[model samples]
Target: MDGQHYMERYIQEVVRRLPKGQRVEIALELQEMIQEMLSADGEEVTVESVLLKLGPPKELAKKYRDDRRYLVSPEYFDNYLWVLRIVLLCVGLSVIFSAVVNFFLDPKQAKEAAMELLYLPSGLLAAFGAVTLLFVILERLHVKFEPSQSSPWNPSQLPPLLQKKAVISRSDTVVGLVFIVLFCMLLTFAPQVFSLYLFSDSKELTMIPVFDMEHWNVILPLILASMMIGLVDEVVKLVTGRYCGAVLAVNAVTNLCQVMLSFVVLKMIPFWNPEFFSWLRKKCDIPDLLPYITEEAFSNLFLGLIVFGTALELGTTAYKSLRYGKN
Candidate 1:
């Protein structure tokens, strides 16, 4: 390729890594700088030589970035990978241990125990994502995990102090996504496992399902859809890495959908276990407690809490995004 093409490719590499708003200006500036350097020699200097002096495109891009954030920069990349490997190994081993214990606990539950092993991949994936996200946030926050042992501690020795910015807490969002995944998995495969266990005086065990499995099956799709929306919202927040009207808007829409799905689950469908109340009456000595506690009443209380939580999240996001969105 010609020198001009090489220069164009080099500029494109650096500018493409930048935000869209800065790309055009930065690209033009880089072209001018390269041209000046090429002319300053007063001889035909190869574009390769000029590019070499400028350094790699990735490093040049980093210099151009005002924020200087990286997912896992070279300095801490080794530590990040170390932690990631440990996390994944721990997650895998824990899943295996749980599965083994479950199998031994009830030898007849072999199929059920096998199902537990299926979670290993998801658990490892979540662990990997969480660790990577934590590192990314730490990078953006300019947090140092490995301070130099050779040098004495001094304020001057510190890395460039990062300015406080309105960034979406990527770690928290990842955690939320993990929980959503777990919740959806539970509802999808083993929701019947969520039960109230009672042991009689004779050591007899009784299990009462938490929700009417029949009705739960009916609303499962809606619940899953709402959760999927929640996942999308978190992913958007993760990508944006800053609170703004767009994030707030997404939060508002997802929360609304969740609230509606919750309403349908709680009010329209007979979600609670039908025999749960009767079992309580039969099994409990506290008669007065049973009188005040009805399925409808419990549903209403849960719905109210969901609404309250939604309101609080929306309010907080609005305050932050509106206040510091431009920043």
Candidate 2:
């Protein structure tokens, strides 16, 4: 490649590692800097020599970011903010949803519904703390979105411009993470809410608890751990913002942990409330349903579904990683 091609390749490699919004502006600045350096050298210095003296595109990109002083660091800051926004959105929506549900359930208790709004600030604070903590851990571990700094880089090693398909969607990852967080929160704070609500003849509302509280309490930590593994997996996706072997490996490992934890939870005991089935059968007048959908049978069915879902996720992630990793 000639001087122009060399410069373009170098600029592309640097900016492509950065956020999309800043890429154009940074590319222009880099081009101007390279031109100034070339002009200063007159006709004696080749573009290759100039680039070599400037060092690798990766290092130059770091200089452009000037991200050395922070706990999370600049490279990961954009993603940190992205995750924070999604978490806050999820928290806010949960508060609103809770308030709305309470209001609909009992108009006389509108004051109580209004009181639920107080949880908003606390929820947002918790969300911020969780996201910051995750980023800090990543930073401490030196988890990098860019290629590792241990490798040598040269002008010839300039990576090609990123392809469209190689990019992971922030929105999609956010949606998935929001669901995971909400599910975790629901189980932790209000597991009993997963109940069958009924209206009695006297217009009294009745809630039949789904899971035996004793059993749920016993297994809650394991379930939360499983969910946390999933949370970490999504964090990896957010940081990398693209498909790669690392993402595939993390996905596989986390999914496997989730599978094992889920199996353990299912095997420890039947989670269903002992009274729930009897009440359900009485209410529905379907005593025969017990034979077909016993606790053991339900546990087996749930385990099978979890295994199938994990397999599907691993397969999809593998295909995407391999297809885009080459790019």
Candidate 3:
């Protein structure tokens, strides 16, 4: 290519990689620099020769950005991976659940379920792209997320050191972690597992999922966040091997959030499938055995259980916090 044409290609490559705000100015600067280099060479110069002297367009773009071109810097790379893993795990679980439900919903559609599994790669790619984009934004914004940079620690807040026998059990932590992961997967993917089922003479099982899929977008995220918090709490407990004020505080906060989220979801969405109730009432031979199946009754019961669980957690956390405070 001619000198001007070659320079245009090289500048386009560099400018395209750069942020939009800096593209024009950097392109002009690069052009000027190339011109200076060519003039200083004191000989006929091709664009190829000039670009060759400048190195790869990618590296040249980095230079314009002062070498801040990493999609995720080393400092945030671990966090990026951590977030990516969580996102992928959630997505994978949801996909798996959907596949299983589809298969069970109609055995003849097993092929469709298999086909649905094919979407996993694209789903994962989309999730990865989103997470990487977020990390890239954070990196460009120079957002620091050091846990140690938080409020100063107080020694007085430490819990009483427990005896070796009384320390947190590694097995318990491992089991809890596994349960949390599985719970998140099931909740995200196969929530229908919690639904009521009725078998008919046709040998087909009619299933009614506990929560409406329509509310999934709102409910799942809150539940996932709560599960993540629980996962972190378990990790912390395992690492520390003892309950401390910090642990108690985190547990309490997680419990509180979960309770609030549960209330919000229960209030906003119908928990029991009305169709399931109607089917059961019609198909079942025993009328007196069946309890009332109104939406309000089921919702109130579910909400009560959630509130009770949250209260129990808060009570335990408070007790532990007080014990730690005494120490």
Candidate 4:
């Protein structure tokens, strides 16, 4: 096999697996390696020659795959990051999918299902957050990450709550309860007057079937259940907040449980075109109107949350900034 054929086969395999940037670099490097080997004036560097030198394709692929950050790292990542990766993957996929769905769905379907279906992500956050809690517990039980063995990222720097400090305060518990109740009220009643304004011009509401009474029975319970969940979340946030210790992880769990519950209600209820829900619950899914919520709203809400978490974490940067830096 000529040197050209030798390089072609190796290059093809490398190109197929690598991202374009890395592939270019690796290709250049391999070309250099091939040229150097060919000119060495020892064994003739043919396709067979290079093939014998570079080792098997499988071995090369594994080396390349291991060369960078792994898709799932059982080594060095420690269980916390490992769990985080899974959660992040799930939430990212769901967010993307929901965004796509909302983009195309009729605006009417989006509104009816959007706010109430936050339960999906809430559930995912809960499940993964629990895994994180377990990892924390293991650390408390003296789990060690050995250099020789692959372990989750060391969680020693994690907060006292996450790192086994009894930092959960009575004040946090009370405040969480208060907000949960407040949220319940807001979600359930939602100032129907306000909603009426928001929906006044919506085509879906406007195009309501002339004989719409039948679907009301199916949809109304979903609306009601959502109100109840705000309360549940408040209580959960209070409890999870104190226990999990990692503020973000706790919020994610609290949110995830709601998301799961949202899915259950959306799946079980009749409000979203009873016929469609009926058909989908059996054959597919009555997914929430994920795409309906404006990305702007998501961003704003996420920002607010980050601000709130930071307030708790940093003891109110705004207050400090104002007191020390401002008048």
Kindly list the per-residue Cα lDDT of model 2 for residues 1-327, writing each as its tens digit. 778888888888778656567889999998998989988989888788889988887778787666566777766788888888877887788777777776776779899889988888988898899889999989898776445656666677765545678778878888789888888767754565688888999988877788878777677888889988998999999888788888998999999999999888886666788677777556665666757556677788999999999999999899888987653
Ranking by lDDT: 2, 1, 3, 4
lDDT of each: 0.71, 0.81, 0.66, 0.43
Number of the top lDDT candidate: 2
Cα displacement (angstroms), candidate 2, residue 86, comes to 1.5
lDDT of 3 by residue, 19-105 (tens): 556778988998999999998987876556667778766556666554344677544454456556766786777787788887877
Each candidate structure's count of clashing pairs:
0, 0, 0, 19
Collision pairs in model 3: none
Which residue pairs in model 2 clash with each other?
A: none
Off by over 4 Å in 2: 1-9, 16-21, 32-50, 99-119, 145-151, 279-290
lDDT (Cα, 0-100) at 183 in candidate 2: 81
TM-score of each: 0.59, 0.84, 0.54, 0.29
10 residues in a row with least lDDT, candidate 1: 154-163
**Root-mean-square deviation of candidate 4:** 22.4
Better of 2 and 3 by TM-score: 2
